[model samples]
Target: MHSFSTAVLALAASATVVLGHGHIRRVVVAGQTYPGFERWANTDQSNDVTWSFTTDNEGPIEAANVNTADIICHQNAKNAPKSVPVAAGSSLQVVRFNTQGGFEHPGPEMHYLASCGDSGCANVEKTSLRFFKIYEKGLVKGGMADDPDWNMQKWATTEVHKNVQPEGEGFIDTYTVHIPADIKPGNYVLRHEVMGLHRAHLGEAEFYPQCVNLEISGSGSQQPNGVNPMEMYHASDPGVALDIWVDLESYKIPGPAVSSVASKRDIESSPTLKTHARDIKHWLSKFMA
Candidate 1:
């Protein structure tokens, strides 16, 4: 009986790893926090239209599958409806959670945006979407607190690290990116991704990516071009199949370089804006629950 119970417990733990990894469950837009995949799955899009709800598991994608079609937007984001409305020049904060615990993975965080039409979220083909990077957070010097640049990230410095510390007991989870004010008005999808390096020692880096649908309102005409979805990252890319445990100081960030079409200072200087980048406590209360 003891052996049987042990087997049963093992099976349950495996199931949780397969079905309950992590996902973006909350987003903050203009200081208002809105429920993401979790809440939307029950109330707004009950039919499992969003990939976050219908995916077989929230487990991280294996590095070998980085080039597969699944890499485009992960499981079922293609048909997910645009669930949120955001304005240009606004800072959007994405919050991720694990079913078993808080974010426990350690690696870089990335944010990308793709333009679709006014109602394009309801029916977007993965291939038809092109993405441009708006925010990225990579490891600092040696990833140790003693390192001079320890808390100084190469990108997304203020927003991503505001809630969590790098390599802390809990996963450094929250990330923020600004919607370019110069972007043309339309519906867009925000693609957020986190690369987990805990298992990178085995050449099996894990990728957690989710797409958030939104309607963006703004006035600018510079639509940025992006690489083909299939060509975004290669399985052999240093960033994809890496061993983060070995190299502490010489790690190079994987994937395409960050591209921004707007100046970040503009967001902070807008006369009508009430809060700027240093508003750390704004998003803390919402995620406390």
Candidate 2:
């Protein structure tokens, strides 16, 4: 069996040719980073903390499958075995690994949280978990006369890509979401997703959904009810079947509304992209040696 580091190195090497599709490589909470499930590598997930998927490719579920259980996370996703502790009212960064370039699709990004009751999130029935929206960012600005490129720069995906070094040459980018401050402390599943509307006009919008097990710590007392994943979206939803190539006046984010108790924060106006090529090269040298 290949070691974890070897698997990562192999995946990194292959990333140079893959395009469009991506997945969560890791997550950052309270300044500590936790590894995310690499669906394509090291499939012995007995010790994985992130939800598991059946496929090795980093692909998205089609909008046609929005009502299916696959939309709950990804394709044939299984519950994670462990939960990471996170403080309420703190930021959680979902770091993505884009295969060859920046996120090539234009879309909205969202975050949801579902409490796992007392038994915890590791093995809970996914369909029974009710998810309340904690964060949702759609089109920032566009459909104006003077603006060219359809204001793509203001898109949520664009903002995420800003985290990649050299604009479009790097493989890593991040999206930030905040845990609601008033939510009751307990085990919860953090569902982070992005919808690629580049081909939405053809009813082929792409949905990339991922889940993480979180054990929240706080002194709050609120457990808001939420919609089930199966009922959260529809094929004909305005946001799910829109045309971004044309002049769109605005966009309606798909799914349930953001919970009243959800925390809100401003995005960084100027984000710095840190380079990781040198580090990857160093690891490759050792592996080759």
State TM-scores per candidate: 0.70, 0.79
lDDT of 1 by residue, 149-190 (tens): 224312232234346533323243566667887878787777
Report the C-alpha lDDT of model 2 over 1-289, residue by residue, as the tens digit: 5456434433443332234477777788878888788765656655556787775567788888989999998889989887778888888888878756756566788889898987778879998999998888877655421111234335677656665743243487788878888989999999999877766756678898989999999998988998899999999998898655554456778898888887545322121111245456789999999
Relative to the unseen true structure, what is the C-alpha lDDT of residue 173 in candidate 1, on a scale of 0 to 100? 56
Q: What is the lDDT of every predicted structure here? A: 0.59, 0.74
Pairs that collide in candidate 1 are 51-76, 103-171
* Candidate 2 worst ten-residue window by lDDT: 266-275
- Which model scores highest in TM-score? 2
Runs with alpha carbons beyond 4 Å of true place in candidate 2:
1-18, 43-47, 144-153, 166-170, 264-289
- Number of clashing residue pairs, candidate 2: 0
What would the TM-score be for candidate 2 when compared with the true structure?
Answer: 0.79
**Quality of model 1 by C-alpha lDDT:** 0.59
Error of 2 at 260 (Å): 0.6
